[model samples]
Target: MEFWTGLYLMSFLNMACCLPKSSYTVYLNKLSFSTAQSHCLPGSFLANIPKEEEMAEILKTIWDKNDKTATSFWIGLQKNKGDCYRKDLPLKGFYWTVDSSTQSDVKLWETEPSNTCLELRCGLLSVKYGETAATCNGFVETTCRQEHPFICKRNATVTCRRPDILGTHDIIDYSNDKDTCYVHCASGANFTLKCSKDLVWTVLGNQNMDTSQLCLECNKGYRRDASGYCVDVNECEESKPCTHRCLNTDGSYKCACSDNDMDDCDGSKPPTTDLTRNDYSNVNRGKSLLTQPTSLPDDVRTNETDVHIEESVGDVSNIIVPVIIALLIFIVLLVIVAAIVKGCIRRRTTKLSRRKAEAVALNGSNSMEKVNEKEET
Candidate 1:
């Protein structure tokens, strides 16, 4: 009896561990690749056969289905936009739709009827020689617009199915070990779920707990209303984060300053200068102040230095204006003095010449008188 119980336990454990990781479902309904993908949404996705064994398994599954109309079935392999062909590489730039990181098995491609990646192409497994009775070979490239029967794949583990209690807005995340599923709602509420070995989902330590009680927390910039839905929180009315004017946005608030109070509205002080404070004593200060170490911040020091430079330029201009005026006055006075001295010299030379001429005439008159007296005697 003990041996029989041990054998039964071992068989159960072996069956549990040997369970397939995924399962495939073939849909004979002809549909485009996009439509087929859409049909597989919410839980499953397009089939991905990454290994030769998996491809063989899928082909065997298709053969077992015995669909007389399906000549080819769409797979998850597709050449996305901007993906060109590479003659040296396997799969020729095609990627699996479910997990692009998994490379397609190189042996799962046929050699005949070679195809090129000239356009957006999707992949499908074709029946050899177009015979429905024939087994499917490797995949072949075809346009995505072509209608064909498709295969969808989903996780086949004994784990619980993903819950949909939180509606379409809920995001589900799995742990690295894939033992725990975390459901996060847009309303900022979070719920924890675990799959037991018995194929049951336990929600927050209870198997049949009310999900409405899980949505208690609110997200940032949102608040729960009376209807239990998350609504936008008016930060302008509630928090008043703005200094001057507060404008409410969808999930945030904008702060604005008036034209006159443009400075310091964003919680930063305005740039200041000595001239703005009407302190002229430091107008002639030298660069020594800059060379010396100070306790002021770098930005403050930079602003003060720039202001000092501007004020120094203005002071230099003030001194230059007076100097220019004084030079002009001195030049005008020098010219007038030169002109007066030239006029006086000209007058003195004229008077000296007239006196000499007068002396000469008087001497001639006296000589004439002496001559007349001699003639009379």
Candidate 2:
């Protein structure tokens, strides 16, 4: 009894799941950071072969119960380069649904793609050139799109670990000790035994961080879903569409208008204090009504909300635009400088804060001495 199930493929292990296709084909060659974020599973995905083996068993159950030929598909199994690695696709085309990772047909990726650093793709296959990373939506070449078999990946079944471990594991090779693996429990599970990368060890049972949830894709802006990867959160989308100025941060975003911020601490609209403290009260009134909520009756709201949203957003953008520009300029400058400085630059930046603190202490001591002399006189 094999019925066609919509396939939702994940281009990368730590990215979001691709939308379930009515009839779609994915031959991933290079999934970018955004791809990693976008196609990553909803919760967490197993990045280890052992875990994938568990996942494959579940797949086998479904295939065994169904009456259909196995489809050609891709699974994550690349060489263990200290970077992202994807393995080659097996000839029969192994899908994530296959349960046996140890099968002879399983392909493995080549180990050494880099000379000294981490800057390439891994898993099903390795991208030869260096990372020219792009956003999730960006399009690139893929392997031939010949139809083989289909892969069906539903959300990880509610961790069957209630009787066992209730979450997925984030395994990092112990940096200090290669033999051990530092595991972290994702899904926001409240396990607080932060083990050093060296101290972290995997277990068939007992104590360790339960990585129930895999790293999830951050929302657009601040965290963006690039072509087939997860990227810096795109603050552009998270900023309330109703606000005038939107700025993105590492984990969150903010919105503002000249002389007033529409953003609150939690990144939501502000309270009356924010409104009353606004100095641009008159300027705000005279400005176009871009920030106004457009939930009015559909007839009265004739103008496209998108256009209005743009208009409202345009004003506060003055401040943010300069900041954005400045940030970009700064980034460009940093890149150029970095290209020149390389390892030295990285080392200096690491130690810079300490230098600044030391300078501040010396200045404070001099100021205190001067104050004491003046008081004595």
lDDT of 1 at 244: 58
Q: Candidate 1's error at 109, in angstroms?
A: 2.5
Instruction: Write model 2 residue lDDT over 1-377, tens digit each, in one string.
Output: 12322232323532544422121123233343334323534423312223434334434432443433332233332222242322343322222222435334323423333332243232232222113321111111123222222222323332222212344545555344333344444533222223222223223333442333223433544321212133575546643542455666666666564335544334354222232313333323443543653533342234344445666788788789899999999999989987888978788877855655665577787755665565469
- lDDT by residue for model 1 (1-377), tens: 99999999999999977765676778899999999998876457888877767776777677778766677889888887667775555666787887784365644566432445457888888765335545656778888999999988765544565654644346476645354677666656566766543345556566665444445555677765433456799987887776556667776666655424433334422233213323333432546554664744565556566777887899999999999999999999999999999999999989866755665577786755665565469
In model 2, where do residues sit more than 4 Å from their true spots?
Answer: 1-37, 44-48, 51-118, 125-377
lDDT of 2 at 281: 39
The lDDT per prediction is 0.68, 0.38
Candidate 1, lDDT over the whole model: 0.68
How many steric clashes between backbone atoms does each model show? 0, 60
Taking every candidate in turn, the Cα RMSD to the unseen true structure, in Å, is 18.4, 35.9
